[model samples]
Target chain A: MDLKDKLVSSFMAFEDGIDVNDPVHDIRSEAIKNFETKGFPSKKEEAWKYTSLNNLQKIDFSVFPKQESALEYKDIKKYFLHEIDTYKIVFVDGIYSSYLSETTHDGVDVCLMSSALTKPMYRQIIELYFNKIAKKEDSLTSLNTAFSKEGAYIYIPKNKAPRKPIQILHLATGNEASLMLQPRNLIIAEENAEVQVIERHQSLTSNEVFTNSVTEIFAAKDARVDYYKLQNDNANASLIDNTYIDQKDNSVVRVHTFSFGGKLTRNNLNYYQNGERIDSTLKGITILDGKQHVDHYTLVHHAQPNCESHQDYKGIYDGSSTGVFNGKILVDKIAQKTDAFQQNNNVLISDKATLNTKPQLEIFADDVKCSHGCTIGQLDEDALFYLQSRGIPKKEAGALLMYAFANNVLESVRIPELKARVNKLIANKLGVRLGFEL
Target chain B: MLKINDLHAGIEGKKILKGINLEVKPGEVHAIMGPNGSGKSTLASVIAGKEEFEIKKGNIELDGEDIEEMAPEERSHNGIFLSFQYPVEIPGVSVTNFIKTAINESRKAQGLEDMPANEMLKKIREKAELLEIDRKFLSRSLNEGFSGGEKKRNEIFQMAMLEPKLAILDETDSGLDIDALRIVANGVNKLRGSDNAIIVITHYQRLLDYIVPDFVHVLHDGKIVKSGGKELALELEEKGYDWVKQETVA
Candidate 1:
């Protein structure tokens, strides 16, 4: 059977393991109906024009993993921010790994979604904040909402800051030939509270793995959130990440995505500015080669006045790799004085490589400043000659120029350790060792 | 130390340097004076192995080894440096990092380990002092937002750092004031000795006053039309480039 039909039929069996009397089951049941009517997105859709999920649906993926899989700290330590202390919420094969997690309830709640969903003490918070910002109409998001069981659930109460950043890690073992995962995340920062989060989904086996994940973030008045999505999975893995963020008055939120490896990856990041003087920043750096494909689809909705949003994305494609960027900015009639800017720059490393970039702006207000600039070309030949004339080889010279092109967004990273790790990843991806740090 | 024998080159089937021949030994500086578009910069670029120029005939030799087939970096490894007329701006790469990478890559090509940090820093400090450059300028991105004089000064600073055997200054004095010119010339003078050579290519004779050359040649329409001693530069300056152009036609 096709994947959608299989998922639709598996709902009964999926609900059998859980309490069917729970009120949340009603929401899940509603979501499955929505997804059943609208299956996987096709290339005909304007948003999915460049990215197609047809081949992914061809593989018969196991909707539900069998059980828990074990992993030692020594085996997967390289994936975490191990250099510094962090609150870790780790999952293996869609099951929470308490042994590998470093959760805490001291001053804030940095624990499991399952605990927040099944337990009584955390019921009120879940009912209030869960899936409030995630789009209910997007087929993939609705599909994730249908199977949403366990992911990271973070709650920073009013006037409190987390002692350390949080890391939400999901690892998929090759226990099954083909597996599919839907992990839902909810993050809420109350008034004057702050938090930093780093999320990554990794696949350990050479088998095919697909992840359809959704995350909803709420930044209250004067609150701050720094979210990082690092996608460096294996060659057999494919991920579709859908993240939504809502900002309140004077709140600031920033999301940085670094896509280095994967067979096919797509990011649908949306931001809604609900109050005045709010700020939203989205930045990405994608470097791919070897037939890999990465697409970035972003939207910023300005509903209030005096708000600002900035988007800067850079990509480098090589060896027949493909890249797509579709950025949209929508300013409502009342969103006067909105300062929205978007810049997307791409480089094709080979004649076979391809890139498609489209920038959209639908402004209903006259006084707002909304502009976007996009370019897709190869690296500058003159710049390459300049480096080569300085005793750097041709290959290394090209790498240095590309590195400089993509390094502009690294300065916005607030965490020094994460910045350093990403810096190394960029250098490794470019296959050149610089004389020193940029 | 450097020789070019009957070198005829051009770009895109258009001849730029035709049958050019010149030689310079160690401890000597040769000044090539020309009008605009007289192939002075083209000659420097051809010797530095710029692929845009097609060598229709002849070869360039450094220490008696013909380097016609070497890449630009290989030519640089063999001690050939060309200070660009218009230095490119590379954002996000600091000047210190750019020079360090260049030096280390050359060393690595020769199978030598990277220079120690302290030793490299000491060399950088010494060079900065010789050029009278501010310490903060070295930390900024390479040539980004630099004034014309600052760009020229940076080109000279890179020359001081690399210490090439054959340094060709191509219009390095175009955008400099007298004070900057004196500083750049002084740095070049300090870098010269009995073991290296210099080729100064300029349109105006003003820079030749600070960095005097042992020989001077006037080029016209891709060929050297006049060759003389240091007095040749003063003669051309007083009479203008038309003197050589008219003489070539006669």
Candidate 2:
């Protein structure tokens, strides 16, 4: 058999060993069938033109293995965790680790996707909403759905707002040469409920790994959810992350993604303002050096009248790295009075660096206010000279100005813990300490 | 404290400061008056070591050190300052943070340790009050949404914070109202000492009335055509730039 057929056979064999009667198992089977029909996308695909997943098809990724080493919190705390007070939920190799998780809030329910799937209510919700928002044409979405085993499920009841944020830590550790981890998260904020969720993925081993994660967020009427995803995998790691968000009437959803470390990273964010008076804001910052390649694709769909969406994605490419931003805003005919704005700005710090930015808007409504713009340039010479004239050395001044450029998006994060974590990530990516006084 | 000998500079291959000569000893305040495109700002920028301006021929001396080829930061470390006519608006960087960075950088360049936080905050508050600037302005982004007068005052506040030996005010009074001009001039005068010098570059004599210059030079067609006492500003203000142009032609 060819490689494609052999891969499909392997996946089918793996699925037969696990229980298939559960709802999640049933969904997995359907997803695998979907993936078998649509294998890895190539450069010919419109969306996948700038970002090629051809490298992923060449590797034979192994399923997650049983735990072989003891998980330590000290390294996690020293590198990824901070002092911010929050409800911490830790997952090792995609499985929920109870000993590493803690929560003090009473109004919220945080549980493993496995446990939540057992409950009829959560299972019904997941069955109805899971894998429903991301487009079916996306091969990565199908791949994530087919390989989903361990995940986190957070549910905030109606009229409840948690005081502290919910921190989700995904730690990848194993002796395998190439480990493939699929972390799935479903967050449902009921009507008028508010919550802050922070999802951080880090690698505990130096082995080459690939993390495929899919997160779905649902904000009900009048509910507000602030979500932050920090991807700081090991230098040798690669990740494909897909996040889908849906908003109801008068709901607000904000997603901030920070890409700091990875050899090859691709993030797809799909936001749907499906109800009137709903609003969504998507912001991302990608700092890449070395041969790292980062691609961000965002789609903001205004499906209802009077809905609003804004997208701002910026990148700082250094060394021989490459960054890509493809953002699209779609305003349907019925979505009149829609207000959407999208902007992608990039800075090339090295001569060998490259950036590809495309901002697209498709508005069918006559009364809509839609605008999109993209800028790719180097650092502002005047600002640099201003800083240098104040006695700051050239390098420190450049670093400070770059940090200030990133602070525009970083300051918008409402959750303090996630903000601090993102700041550290940015510092590390720039090869500078967090508190470089000079 | 500062001297410029036959300075010739330009931007993008076009000459601006042609054979300009000037000298300012400690405790002296000199004014450079010029018409449009006469390169008043160019001279200040060149003195501050801005790289955009190419100096074809000239020598700039600060405290007996040749600074013609030095970078802007090196010039700043040697006690040179320029109060930019149009200060940049840096979003997401607070005024306090910018000033602290400037102070720390200047100190470190001078072989001094970074100042303690308490002491730095106290000094900033004192300077802010002296310039009639609200303490809250320190927390705002650096000149992000500042008004014309506020930007000028912020420049003076930075001048006070840095305490350079030679402070070049390049059209610092252009966008300021009379009251703001008075406050900025007062800040400059208060910071002036026997060990420092000031260069006021302006077109009108309004700012000169508040902070009187000891000497005034008329710059026309990229060259200084006339030099006189502070009264020369009033004469130029009365007759306009045409008089200076006519004199240069004669």
Each prediction's DockQ? 0.81, 0.60
Q: After superposition, how far is residue A207 of candidate 2 from its true place, in Å?
A: 1.8
Docking class of 1: high
Clashes per model (N, Cα, C within 3 A): 0, 0
Q: Per-residue CA lDDT of candidate 1, range A71-139, in tens?
A: 999999999989899999999988899999999898899998888888999889888888788998899
What would the TM-score be for candidate 1 when compared with the true structure? Answer: 0.97
- By how many angstroms RMSD does model 2 differ from the true structure? 2.1
Supply the global lDDT for candidate 1.
0.92
Instruction: At residue A244, give the lDDT of candidate 2.
Output: 91
lDDT of 1 at A387: 87
Distance (Å) between predicted and true CA of B203, model 1? 1.7
